[model samples]
Target: MTIERTEPATDAAERTMLEGWLDYHRNTLAWKCEGLSDEQLRTASVEPSELSLMGLVRHMAEVERGWFRKVLTNEDAPPIYYSDEDQDGEFHLTESDTYQEAFATWQAEIETARRNAARFALDDLSEGKHRRTGEQFNLRWIYTHMIEEYARHNGHADLIRERLDGSTGD
Candidate 1:
């Protein structure tokens, strides 16, 4: 079950470049989880930390929903796996959680994010305000931020995957 990742195009427009990098990072995360069982995916192989590949998948789904559906498009979207009471639930998995469900939700959120993003131009302002500062952001800023988020998390994913099975690559 090897996951296939596409390399970003060297020469492209701003949107194409941004999206290509983002998709690359996204697939990189999935690639890290490939060929692992549910328990393997949920293992906190990174000692002294609770981060797992499944947790990263869940976290990214929440991120996609939060930024795209909740903020960008102003949809009444709520956290998929976490709440105010359990803020880190996405990273706190149980035996009941399945990798299939987690991956499906993550993929669905990714698709929704793309659809929601299509409604606005790069310079268009988000319909919702930032939770911390109450300031609005443009779509371009959101895209850049999302790319950064994925890139950072994918690095974590790489470390975790390598620790799990001694596998490593871009």
Candidate 2:
């Protein structure tokens, strides 16, 4: 499943509009995680939920990998996050991994996603079919879906980070 991206947009305005939403979503999620201590970042709100600042960062790494690389780019690389295994890998409760490591992974994944997205014109229809559903979605639609998903999670991150510490937006 190779993703062949065609240049679909002929104008600058269209390109900027598409890029803006991607930028907006990335910033929103990062803003939610800003200014917290290691302890604060690791704290989950309560039992029965695995969400935490660190966990979100790890999960989003996998999210980026899934949508951009696997789905959009049609890469066969395994998704970054594992459900049955790698439990501690994302939540990362141990003192072994630093904030920098988790943050870096997210950054690198986003950059990879950005490069893949840039391969196409903003509205270009995707060349690869979705792996699971075999449905077709344009590059534009994928960007919009990512923005919506990240925005939703970022809201949850906002409340969690707030509780972790009084620190707020960047």
Candidate 3:
């Protein structure tokens, strides 16, 4: 299915601006993967890299869960697709994974992230520490980091989508 992207407003409050840009990037990822078959979605178009459109969807879902649910809300959310033994599972796809399910899970996680974020002000600090750095952070930092994360992954998505069908755009 095709996903429609809404451009961020040029002028807005800090919260609105952050959320709008994030939503734009999120939709861009979906648009990049839209209307493709399961095989197409799973194609590691950029050889030597394990990245795939489907894997990206899964990765973003995990990212949303981590920053929003786990860090922001201090919820005990586990990884959706990875483990210690398979830390990069989000970028690893098999024939058993379905694009429909990945998209649904990603969308759900997005909604959950929004709900979790709505509970706190931008300056509110997380109760949990960063997994790697062991440093605490605020909601504002999380929002900015998530935007950067999606922006970077969306670039990868653009390349993969183009390789799959020569399609390209914002």
lDDT of the candidates, in the order given: 0.90, 0.73, 0.91
TM-scores for the candidates: 0.96, 0.80, 0.96
Q: Using alpha carbons, what is the TM-score of model 3?
A: 0.96
lDDT of candidate 2 vs native? 0.73
User: How many clashing residue pairs, candidate 1?
Assistant: 0
Better of 1 and 2 by lDDT: 1
TM match of model 1 to true structure = 0.96
| Model 2 agreement with the true structure over 17-130: per-residue lDDT tens digits | 666666766776666666666777778867867678788888888878877887777777675556557644566456665567788888899999889988976567666667
Worst 10 residues of 2 by lDDT: 1-10
**Evaluated with lDDT, which candidate comes out highest?**
3
Clash pairs, candidate 2, are none
lDDT of 3 by residue, 1-170 (tens): 56777766778889999998899999999889888999999999666988899999999999999989888887999898999999998888989999999999999999999998998899999877778888778999999999999999999999899999999986
**For model 1, how does the per-residue alpha-carbon lDDT over 1-170 read when each residue is reduced to its tens digit?**
66777876788888888888888888888888989999999999666899999999999999999899878988898889999999999999999999999999999999998898889999999999777788788999999999899989988888888898889987
All-Cα superposition RMSD per candidate = 1.1, 7.2, 1.1
- Local distance difference test, candidate 1: 0.90
